[model samples]
Every structure is written in C-alpha cells, then in structure tokens.
Target: MSTPLIPLTLLLILTAVLVESQSIIPIRYDGFVYKKRAASTGTVLIEAFYDPVCPDSRDSWAPLKQAVDYYGTNVVSLIVHTFPLPYHDNAFVTSRALHIVNDLNVSATYHLLDAFFKHQEQFYNAQTLGMSREAVLDQVIGFASSTLGNSFKSAIKSGFNDSKTGTKTRVSFKYGCSRGVYGTPFFFVNGFLVPFNDDDTIDYNGWRKLIDPLITKKQHYPSNIF
Candidate 1:
C-alpha cells in the first residue's frame, strides 16, 4: 500500500524550521577566539578584515576609530579580523604578535595595532631603511614590548611559535578567504559589504552616512541617556 502524503503547510513549516536552524548555527573553527568591540545586540556591526602592514589599512585606522568612538557600544560594534597578505613580509609575524597580545590583554591589542601603523615606515619600509626582515620583525616586537611591557615581550619570545597562535593566524586568513576578502582594509556593515572607492583616503563621513540611518531607525537609546 502507498503511504499518505504529508500536508503542504506542514512541509513548508518544516522547511522554515530547517532554514532557521541553519541560520542561527554558529560557524566554529579551531584556533583564536573571535573578538568584538560591542555586544551582538547592537544595531550596527562593522567587520574589518585588515593587514597591519598594508598602507591602506594604516590610513583607514583613524577614521575607523573615530566611528567606533562616535557610536560607542550601544548602537555599533566593530569586529576586527586579521588578514595578513603574503607580500607583506612582516605581516604574519605582526598578526601573530597581535593575537598573543589579545590573549594577554584584549585592551592592549588596539594600542599595539596603533603602534604598528604609526611606525609602519620604520619597520615595513625595510628596503628603503636598509634593514632586513629579521630586523623589522625585531623592531616590531620591540615596539610591542616597550608599549605593553616585559610580560608581552616574554610571551612573544615564548609563544610566537605556539601551535595555538599559528592556528589562530591561519584561521583568520581562512575566514577572510571564505568571506571573499581579497585585499586588506575590507569593510562589511551589518553583513552587507560596504563598497569603498578606489582611493587611499578613508571617507569617515561616508561611513557615517551609512551607519547613522541604521542607528536612528533601529537602535533604542539606553534608559540612562536623557
């Protein structure tokens, strides 16, 4: 005997349930835990995939920080993902160093990143400065040590090669690749890729234009704020 067919509405409900389950499921990967500047409830989420050694990434830093400061954590959040491009000889080491710092002190990660960008010329421009890659790496590490302290330096020396660090760095690269990130300083807003112009300048106002409306519409102000 033939079995009775299920109702179409029930099939539709099952399909919807399956789709929702898949959507809510998180993507899990080994290595470094992903970090975010704000809680997931924020209306605006900015995902930045950047390489420390990239000039464009360095240039965008100030404007990005400004946006974070302006919105704070209530309306906006920033998730930083490291994407160390191959040509930047010292990028991987810097990325690894940043990962180590994140483990030790999450707050210091951005400070070290600022240090790297501020002195990119000194370290990344090795050929121009007549310095070797090893020298550049040492300089970067030294900057981290000086800015963060002895423990950071010791961690770098000891844990730079730790499998966990390596795994985190690799996972970052892979995550970027999966997201169609081919270059440094890639930006995504609320899961939508923000189109950047073909120029070195970062348009902070332009970003504000995109972000402000979303905040006005969906973000509820904290009860304490008058």
Candidate 2:
C-alpha cells in the first residue's frame, strides 16, 4: 500500500539533504593559514587548493611560497587547503597528516608541508604500490613526527580518524570541490578563482605583477570609491 509513497519520500529526503549541504559555507579557518595577516582591511588572500603528493602542486608551491614570503605575512594571508586527489595512492593520509599538524602545532604546519614536498616521490603510486593504507599512514606519521617532534607523533597516532582533525581535513577537501577545483595547484586570490590560462601558471615575477597593483591601489585609493 505504501510502496509509491516510500519512493517519493526517499526522493524528497535526498533533495532536502542536498539543499542543506548547499547552504553550508566554507569558513576562513577551514584551511590553515601559512602566512597570516593581522588585519583584514587591506590584506590580500592567496589561497591554494593543493594536493600534497601532486607534482604540479610541488612546482607551484615554490613560487607561491617565495611570493608570499617576499610580500610578508602582514600583507598576504596565504592559506593552503589540502585537496587530496584520490588517484594519488597516499594523498589522503598525507593530507590528513597536515590537518593533524595544524591541529596540534599550528606553527609547524609549514614544516609538515615542507617535509611532504621533500619526500613526495616516496609516496608516489609506484613507490607505494604494494603498501597497505595503514603502512602508508604509518610512514606519513613517522615523517611528520620527524619534522615536528615526538610529542606530535603521540598525538597523531590516532588523529587521522579522530573527530576534529578528520573533520577539518574533510572540510578542506569539500571546500575545494565546492569551488570547482578539478585538479591540483588551483589558486584563489581574494576569494576569486584564478582563471585558467597562460598566466595561471604563476612565477614569482608573475605574482608580483598580480599583487603589486592591488597593494598600491589599496594604499592610494580609498575603499568604496563610489
């Protein structure tokens, strides 16, 4: 008697779930800010959706870091959102490792990122072909602990599936998806996605041209010019 109603009810429930998900927003703290700006008024936000094991992301990281370092944290707030690509064998483990680092020791977040970039090849598909996920996770944990410390190692032993760190990692990836990022090394500046084109592949000089004008404009021109 209720078979027809059951199918219609399921459809309505699924639609409501999607609507709720759409209403959710990504918060600023969803990603760990590597270079923090003290104030928001004139700060330029440089956000990266990066896969830790992705080669393109590794290449993009250097110039991005250099640019942010040159600009100083005062002017640029660089936030790295780890968008772990599924095809990468151990990217999720490494991505979760970052959230764990950010959770336990916010200051060592960059150190963990550097460690991952430094040893990226080890976690590649060929290298980790026969390795189980737990083994890869162990390797990641040890690597992170080495970069951070024994104390962090203790905390992170179970942090991957722990509520807070796991949720943070998941949220960062979800936020990247919601922003329409389909690949590693995607970037956003001031909440606007950087369009795909020749200039999208940015170098230090490229970033300077992009950032300098904005800085100068903010300094000289008043906000709300109209």
Candidate 3:
C-alpha cells in the first residue's frame, strides 16, 4: 500500500523550518577580536585585513581606532586579521609574533601593532630596507618583549616555532583571501565589502559613512519576529 502524502501547508512549513535552522550563522570571534566599550544587540562587526609592514595599513590605523572610540561597542566591534604580504620578507615573522601577543594579551596586541607600524622602518629587512633579516626579527621580538615584559619572551620565541601559531596565521590569511582581500587594509563591515579607491583616504568620515547606514539599517527588527 502507498503512504499518504502530508498536506501542502505542512510540507512547506517543514521545509521553511529546516531552511531556517540551516541558515543560522554563528558569530566568528577569530583573529584579534576587539570589542567596543559597551556591547549591545545591534553592534556591527568590522573585519580588518592588514599587514604590519604595509604603509597603507599603517595609514588606516588612526581612522579605525577613531571609529571605535566614537561609536563604542554599542555600535560596532572590530576584528583584526593579519594578512602578511608575501613580498615583505619579515612580515610573516612579525605576524607570528603578533599572533602570540594576541593570545597572551589582547590589549598588548594593540600596543604591539602600534609599535610595529610607528617604527616600521626599524623592522624592515633587505627586501624592503637595508637591515638584515636577523636584525629585523630581533627588533620585532625585542619590541614585543619590551611591550609585554621579559617574562613573555620565552613564550613568544616558542610561539614562533609553534605549528599552532603557523596554522592560525595561515587560516587567517586564507580567510581573507577567500573573501577577495588582495591587499592590505581591506575592510568588511557587517559582511559587506567596503569599496576602497587607492587615492581615497580611509579617514573617519569615510568609515562613518559606510558604518552609519548599516547601524541604522540594523535598528529595524524583522517584522516576522513576533
């Protein structure tokens, strides 16, 4: 005997329920996740893909920090991903050190980033500058040591060789690559890629323009949610 079919309405409802269950997207707190001062339900996530030695990335630092300071956690959250460019010989090593710093202390990671960008010239090797690779690596590690204390020196050294750190760094780089990030200082605001022109400045106004609309759009809850 053939089985009886369910009602059309019931079948549609079941399909809708299955789709909704599968569509639930989890919040990813990967990389150096920096939350705002006061997080709320409507906080927009900003994913930044940058390289420590990239000048454009360095230029983006102030504006990004300014946006967080202005909006706070109530409006936005920032996730920093290290996408060390292959051309920069010392960038990979620097990124590995940063990953360790991020794991040890999130706050100190910010300081280390600032230090790397501010004194980028000191860490450049022969590929970008006249310094040797050893000297550059030493400078980067020493900077981390100074910023995070000497006790962290051994951990940082071990992190450089640790396969886990390498895996994390590679994963971050691949994540950005999969999302069409070909250059440093690439940004995704709430999963919407922000179109950036090389000549255009990524200042507070630029960021505010992109972010304000998203925040405003998020304020309106779905009508279906009863």
Candidate 4:
C-alpha cells in the first residue's frame, strides 16, 4: 500500500550514505603537504631522506633508480636530506647541487643524482670519500659547468656555501626532521616511515617489498597541466 513512499525513503537514505562516504574518505593528493610535492591523483608518494655522502645511501641508489623507473608516473620521488655525519664534508655541497638542478625545472636533477652515485667511489674513500674542501667545490663546478652552464655552476657553489640562505637545503632538512628521519637512507612510503634493520641489511628486496604494492595500485588519467 505504501510502496511508493518506501522507495522514496530508500532513495533518500542512499543519497545520504553517498554524501557521507564522500566526506569521510580522505583524498591523498590535495596539495603539496609538508613542502614535498604531492603525488599525482590516485598515485603514491615516496619521500626518501638520503645523504649524498652516506655510503649506505649510495648503495641503495641502484635499487631506488630501478623502482622509480618501474613506477614511472605512479610514484613521486620527493628526495630530502638527512645529513648526519660531520666528516662527510661534501654532503651539503651535493645536496645543493641537486637543489639547484631541481630549480632549473628539468630532469637533469635525476641525471646528476645517478651520476653522483655512479662516481661516488671515485670521490669517496675509506675515510669518507677523501674529498678535500677545494676539490668538492671544483667537482660541483665541473659537473654543472659541463652539463648546465657557468651560471648554474656558480649558483650551485653559492647555494652550498650559503646554507643560511639556501631555501632548498632548509626545506629538505625540514622535511627530514618532520618525518623523524635520524639517518641517511631512510625511506617513507605514502608519508609513513619504513621500518629498518630488521634483517640486518638494507637491500633492494626490502625496498621493493615496501614500494611495489603502491606502484601496482596507482591509477593515472590525463591532466590539463602544461
């Protein structure tokens, strides 16, 4: 007898349920949270806090690169600095180099990152990469001048020296501290810090296990950004 009214009531209840779900289900990529670039819509964010002068960090570079390449658009690699040791004098310089390259709005930042790691042994020694202060600046100048230009080279050097004014370095450090990063090679998946030293070795398998799921579940659609 009241079938029409019952249908109407059910429709109203369903609408309310849908509205509540929309409000409660958190959207991940709204904006750049914590100064780290937001992941693309429906994608995962990987915030890596690494030190260029850290031996362990260097060892992780290969696997990290592979993961980034495999994930492609599904992952955003937000690299930050957690420079801990004082003996790694060139660490700050290297960080500034990446920061400057990033400023250029080109992919050269990734290139230099891999290049630096590839040649890490050549620069670093048994006593922390054996890099003298003068040589460190020179290496930066040589790399930037050859690939980018003299202006960029100078900017990199200036950025490294004036830590007081280097916004990028400050931002990186801030991101690290905010995430409770105490050392190099710390990896965060989707804003969550990964547990470390469980197996007494930070190997490629461990990183892949943490990251592969995020990559597989990510979805992408065409964007209007230009």
Candidate 5:
C-alpha cells in the first residue's frame, strides 16, 4: 500500500528544514509592533515569533517586556509574529485571536497578548483536550471580554469567525516558517536572529548587554538608558 501523504509543512518540521524566506528583498517588519518608533530614531528593532499557547513563550514574555520597558520605547521597539505550532490543538485560534485584537486596536493588541501569555494555561491542550474548537474560541472570546471589555466581545467573535483573520494569522505562521523558526520564542534583533544569552535566565540586564552595543555613539540611546 502507498504510504499516506504527509503535508509539506509537517515534513519540513519533522526534518528540521530551514525554509528560505519568500523574498530576498528584505521582508518588511509587518508584525504588530509595540511602542512604535521611527526607524531613523535608531531604535533596536526587535521581532519575535511566539506560539501563543507555548509555555516557553509564556515564560519568556515577562523578561522580554521588562527589557523593553528598561530601554524604553525610544531605544527599543518590539514586533510580534505568532507562529502557532500545529501540534498544539488550540494554538492556531489563540494566534488568530491576537490578529483579531491587533486589527481592532493596535494599543489593545499588546494588552491582549500580555493577557494571553499570562493566562495561556487556561487554553492549553489538557484544558481544552475534549473541547470543541468553537467552544474553546468562546472561552477565548469571553476571556477577551474580561480583559478587553464586553464591547470587544462581539467584534472579536466576528473577527474570530472571519476568513480574513485566519488568512492574516496564517501569514504570520508562514513568515515565521520562512524565517527558519521551528520553535516558539525565537527572536530577531535588527533583522538578525539573536543568539540566546548564556544567562541562566534572561532579564532586563541581559538584554542591556545585548542591546547596548548595538547602539553606536552616534545613535546614542535615551539619556537614562544606562
């Protein structure tokens, strides 16, 4: 009997293939940027690919936020790309929810992102094992309502069910794949994938060591950036 066909994406993941980016012409930082800043302002452009429900992503979130706050938006601007691991049953929906939240409100998206990373366990595989996709989404919508308010619920629900949201979310995933990201919490700084710091745990100080050097004397970071 002929072996069943495996989807290309699954095969790529299984083999740990490095997919080439779709464009050689520098892909734009299209992800949802936090604390947007002007490019010429010499900001540390940070891009991260996070699987919305992944524990590692959750664990890494706080320090990442702290580092950004430490440098302040003047020195750092963060962008998020959700790369939902297909093995995580509800990962896609949660990733899509971020897209929905971003579309509705750029400012609110990060709050929702912060909330998702904070309460991600509520939507984990074990928690949602026997749940229907729609049911889990309802839970997510309710969670958004609590975090983002009741007025956001209907719009969020509609966006969740909309094809456009799914498409945009898929784009995020594909972009991550194209960037050779097979894992959650993969990061890039100034368009290059950042090597993990040797610290037992990364923190604001760890980030300073990584970012400070990038800022040249001419560019110079914020007054209190030290």
Candidate 6:
C-alpha cells in the first residue's frame, strides 16, 4: 500500500526548503500617513520622534521650543512614539501614561511633556532610577480626571493595555528604522529626516537653513488655528 499523503508529508517538505532573499524596500517618507497641523499653511510639518525620559531629548527641548515660537504656526510639530528602553526603568510606564493622556484628548499631554522635562528626576529617582508604573499612571489619571471625567482613567488603562498600542509602537519603530534612527530626538522635516549631530551648535541654524529657504520660496507661508 502507498504511504498515506498525510499532513506530515507536506510539513516535512516545507521544513526542508529554505527561503533566502533581499529586496529593495521602499522607504516610507513621513507624509505617507502624517498630515500637516490644521493651522499650517505654506509651512512644513515637523515630526519629532522622542522619548520623554531621554536626556538628549530633554536638552533639546529648549531649542525646539524656541524654534517653534520663531516659526509659530508656520511649522507643524508632532511628537510620535515614546520608546522606553530597558536601561531606563519605568520609562515604559511613563510613556504609556502619556499615551493615555493623548488618547483622552487631554491637552495635558503637551503640559506633561514639559513637566517630564523639568521633573523627570522626581519621577525617576536617580538613585533608585525609576518610578513605580502605577504611581505614574495615577498622576496622569488624577490630573486628567478633573476636567476629562473619570472615564478617562479607565480608558487610559484600557488603551495602555490594548493591542493597538503595540501596533502603534511597532509602526513608530518601523518609521524610525527606515529613517536610520538609532537615538531619540529624531526630527523629520518635509518628509525627510534632518541630519544633525549632538552638540553640533547648529540646532537653530540648521533648522533655519533648511526651512528659511522653503519659506522664502513661498513653498510655505503661515496660518493660525481657529
């Protein structure tokens, strides 16, 4: 009798075969999914992939703020993807908490970003070097509860634990990977990542150089959000 053509036969054959190949994957520029700020006009969109706990990001916040003010609504700013590394304890929780604020549509997200910069040490004990995840969540939820209603607390918790969060995290990681980002404070302007260096003393100058030309050319003007 012929051996039965069972599932094992197909499985064995497939296991033996090896697939190897490399393809030129298209690099997804920022414009693929991101949109300009509502008030933006004749202006460029700036996507800043940053981690709240990153010192480099904190240090650059001053200049970033200045730049935003200088350009006003001429430039759209977006903070995407908070990657909390293993070395930085509770960093993930901090990010998760912030995501909660964002999901809740609480303006606190931006305020929290500023707070995180100034009081990161409080949240992250230098000696202990990490805040309790639950504690941080409490702080975020408590602040949001007053205006957003208590539902925000539960929703944040849900979103934080939801599968969508992971998906968004991966998308952010993929975008960063495509842009050759190995660190935080990664900035992208007009669908292209800005090439800059740490302590390059050109943070403001570089931004001005790249954007001024475009603004002058009438590629971008300025507008206000109503």
lDDT of 3 by residue, 112-139 (tens): 8888889776555554477666766677
Q: Specify the poorest-scoring 10-residue window by lDDT in model 1.
A: 25-34
Candidate 4, superposed: residue stretches over 4 Å from native: 1-41, 75-84, 125-135, 147-165, 198-205, 212-226
- The model with the greater lDDT, 1 or 2, is 2
- Candidate 5 accuracy as lDDT: 0.77
lDDT at position 219, candidate 5: 68
Error of 2 at 47 (Å): 0.7
RMSD (Å) of each candidate, 1 decimal? 12.6, 7.9, 13.2, 16.8, 6.5, 12.6
The digit string of per-residue lDDT tens for model 4 on 183-202 reads 66777666677776622434
Highest lDDT against the true fold, candidate: 2
Best by TM-score: 2
Please give me the total number of clashing residue pairs in predicted model 6: 2
Cα-based TM-score, every candidate? 0.76, 0.84, 0.78, 0.63, 0.82, 0.63
Steric clash pairs (candidate 6)? 42-220, 42-221
lDDT of each: 0.71, 0.77, 0.73, 0.57, 0.77, 0.55
**RMSD (Cα, Å) of candidate 2?**
7.9
Clashing pairs in 1: none
Any runs in candidate 6 off by more than 4 Å, and if so which?
A: 1-36, 39-42, 72-79, 125-155, 200-206, 219-226
Q: Estimate candidate 4's alpha-carbon lDDT, on a 0 to 1 scale.
A: 0.57
Q: Total clashes, candidate 3?
A: 0
For candidate 2, write residues 89-126 as lDDT tens digits. Answer: 78888898888877777888888898788889998999
